[model samples]
Target chain A: MYDDRKYTEENMPKTGILLEVENTELKDINFGLVTAARDTGANEVLAFTTEELGTEAQNDLARYGVSQLIRLRTDSADITSSPDNCAAACVQAAREYGLEYCLGLATAFGRDIFARMAALLDVELAADVLQIDFKAKTAVKSHFSGKTMATVSLQETPGLLTVRPNAISPVEQPATLESSVFQADIQSQAKVAVKEIKTSDDRKMDLTEAPIIITGGRPIGKPENYAMLQECADVLGGAVGASRAAVDAGYAPHSMQVGQTGKTVSPNLYLACGVSGAVQHFAGMKTSKVIVGINKDKDAPIFEKCDYGIVGDMFEVVPALTKALQQEKQG
Target chain B: MQIYVCLKHVPDTAANITLKGQADYEAGAVKFVANPYDEYAVEEAVQLVEKDGSGEVVLVTLGPSEAVTTLRSSLAMGATRGLLVKTDEKFCDSKTTARALHAAILQDGSPDLIFTGKVAVDTEGSQTPYRLARLFDLPVANEVSALAINDGSAVAERELGAGNREVLEMKTPCVIGTTKGLNEPRYPKFPDIMKAKKKEIKELALADLDPALDPRPNLGKLEPVPERSGATMMEGSVEESVAQLIRTLKEGKML
Candidate 1:
């Protein structure tokens, strides 16, 4: 029941979804892509990238019989790194193939680049889509705004969508991946230029690339306590994270928030300390390799979701846990 | 370096989601205003040109012709000019709206920079800016908390999860969608308001741009969220309230 006009065979790929392979060494190419394709019906299917996990990542997609592997070949040296250019390349490929849908990782670049691409194509973009259903000539994506899931539909053709990275599971097998070269017409009246590139760490760990994450929430009480989370992250050799509530309340900066309005992460280990598990917050980190919740409230939602749960005062629990970890290291 | 700031006339953030028969709220009844996050983006564009003192700042919006009210507001806040991509009210989704902007930007020629809010308050779906960047194949920075431009280059600080930050550098002809922390947007002044009336405000349509591209994902069921019961004010001190709140969160499995 998908729109016949939008899903026409001429647009074989539908929308050309964009994914950037950044710091391949720090990440696994094993992407958990969720897409609503015309050939596959409306059921959300998984896809993979070739950057992080490499050819092995495609093996994971193979399991999803419906999965299609899109190997984005970038002139490694000419990488723009800007989301705008990355999106442009994707759009060009999509348009060239007459695809009706474009997808992207709901990462930092995904948010910034998709806005401009949607504007350029004059299409409404569904951001951080967690669930997508296509039926009766419409594509619906469920997302969270303030409190609840806001299901949006694209009534138009050639729509753009971005999903949180870990929202969908990566298929463990490969599909018949169609290969094509999408070379951007760099001379096409580009509105932006890359003047320079700078990284916070000449070799600093990327939050998304980290194996372990320690996210704090409003329960941290004050901004000063953020250092405590840092202390724990230091012990774990992980990156620090935050929830949107903590950021909006000024307990920490917005970049640190990890929720529906913030960043989605899937580290090998995610330690949510003093974080009250709001649905929005949970939506972002639900796919972590392993979860550990430390909250005084024994009934915390995180306890149900996490593999390990510790109910106690965080101020007392954190220092003791740090000391214990330190002792483990010393011993 | 001519700059364009796209603005959306949206509902205020404080507006509560009212329910209808425990299923859906009447979105039509919601009051709409210029999106707050977009205000910061518009402010950044205007401020960038003003601070640079060598470029023009133009504001753009794609709503009903009445969107002129929003466009004029941008002019009043020091935009050099404004463009209205007029369309029927029902075509307010990101795709059609973005087309109108692309048309206006194309007609206006290549601007050195484009700016928009991270997401519209009314729609609350943050994806248009990136799409536009892809279409134009321009560089972009989103949710930028801080920015600086000099000569033909610009620098921005992007907020990452957990007190983390990334600094980006881009050439001109970039797009920046901002969050609230970028800067405090200025209100309209009488002098500026008078000048805004005299500034040019052009109106165009989807047809005026390239043929309208087909839209993906048609919306089906529109329903409102269920209302929560009235919150109980805890008659206790901070310590007690924290404990009680923790208990309630635990009971709800939210803690």
Candidate 2:
């Protein structure tokens, strides 16, 4: 057990954040993870990355209180191709640094690597946590799809946790940065290899990572109607989403759907256009910082749950909103 | 060929979950259903076996006896039989759960393929299938949106973030975690539901598998998510509402 009084300013717990990269750039969500690590206050934050950490990336991470950046290297195999190798490399780094806590985002890659880490280390993993208290070795996580929250206590050493993206507000805490590299000894061959990665023609950001999203509902009569929402999304530097009803009606694909059965998104702003706001859809995005519902039906369930409600026909409201945003940008 | 589909009985996504105490819930009235993602796995398993014309789909779950309902539902959807690893423990960490599942699978005999939901909705522990893969030394794919099986091998496609898809091929006796967009799960017909009542549901105690593990992460407190209040209704013409929204976004510095 850790003594709370022993954590002085000079001797604090060390937190290792598993950084994620997308398209050769550091993922924006890692900033929030760094901030959450710092908020624990008992830890000196360091970042570990498997991806190449250029000078610019190190500088970016330093601004978020990362005092050191350790890049894991493999001599034999590409770590990115195999999650087992990646987890092995991470475990090596954690052991080398004597890290007391390991943190990561609860995304596809994080889920893959951390599970392996938990198995290898024989430690408990608190997956997709919403809040954490390092001193108490406890975390709060949502259960039953956000309907309830449970506080969990870690019974082992070197706590392992993966937090939901955008759950913590990012705060800038600049620190002097240092960098190092460690090569891990990985012996296991990759059982499953990523043979090919096919990118879709849609170049817009994904709804899960978008800072803002505009979602259409069943009232979107046809597929082309999504163009309007796309235009508005473009103005806001956001992405276009759809309710399950709209996807079922062929107005959009399942990838664009945002509901319980679809992607769960936590954006700064979510504009629901013409959605009746079923509980299933709300469960996916209830954690969004702000929800704005626009619907013709005044009694729609979405109105009661959203931070702002506009009772109006979406056909008229969305176009006007887009025009206003465009003019605002130009002016 | 033999196929196994792992199922978990979770609180219905629509259930109004209420906390009963610091580490418990008022689950007496809550209804449990086959996790929606696991339903996709069940459907895919049935389709694969039916296509082969010489295989059976087995449904397995680790939960209390009431979880038999979940297995029966899968049986109704065309599974050949069911297995329930009965346990009275209220909570088990993902690793322990995986150990139990691994023991159960070994006891029942290894299959050519295994299917599970990518993540359970209640715990959202997306670790079971991968842990099982490691335990059995089998290749595994997760969040698989498409799958094709041939003689002794299988091809799977997993959806990556940012609208990308990764195609992978692995040998047989592999594990696959099914996600949405895999297939439309069939609704069980009345006749099938009636037949499911008579389907064999083998029960085993925790001691039967005798998994050597301990629950690590333990639950501490349970609480309802704090509700968001103070919604401002925008009551105005179309142009006015749009203007107000723009102004509000600017004030929030979100524009």
Which is the leading candidate under TM-score? Answer: 2
- The top-ranked prediction according to DockQ is 2
TM-score of model 2 (CA atoms): 0.95
| lDDT scores of the candidates, listed in order | 0.62, 0.84
Off by over 4 Å in 2: A1-10, B211-217
After the best TM-score superposition of candidate 2, give how far the Cα of residue A108 lies from its true spot, in angstroms. 2.1
RMSD of each: 8.1, 2.8
Identify the candidate with maximal lDDT: 2
Q: Ignoring the other chain, what TM-score does chain B have in each prediction?
A: 0.84, 0.95
User: Interface RMSD (Å) of model 2?
Assistant: 1.6
Cα lDDT tens digits, model 1, A77-188, are 2335444445555555566656556666666666666666666566667776655564543433332244334556655556667765555544343345543344455433
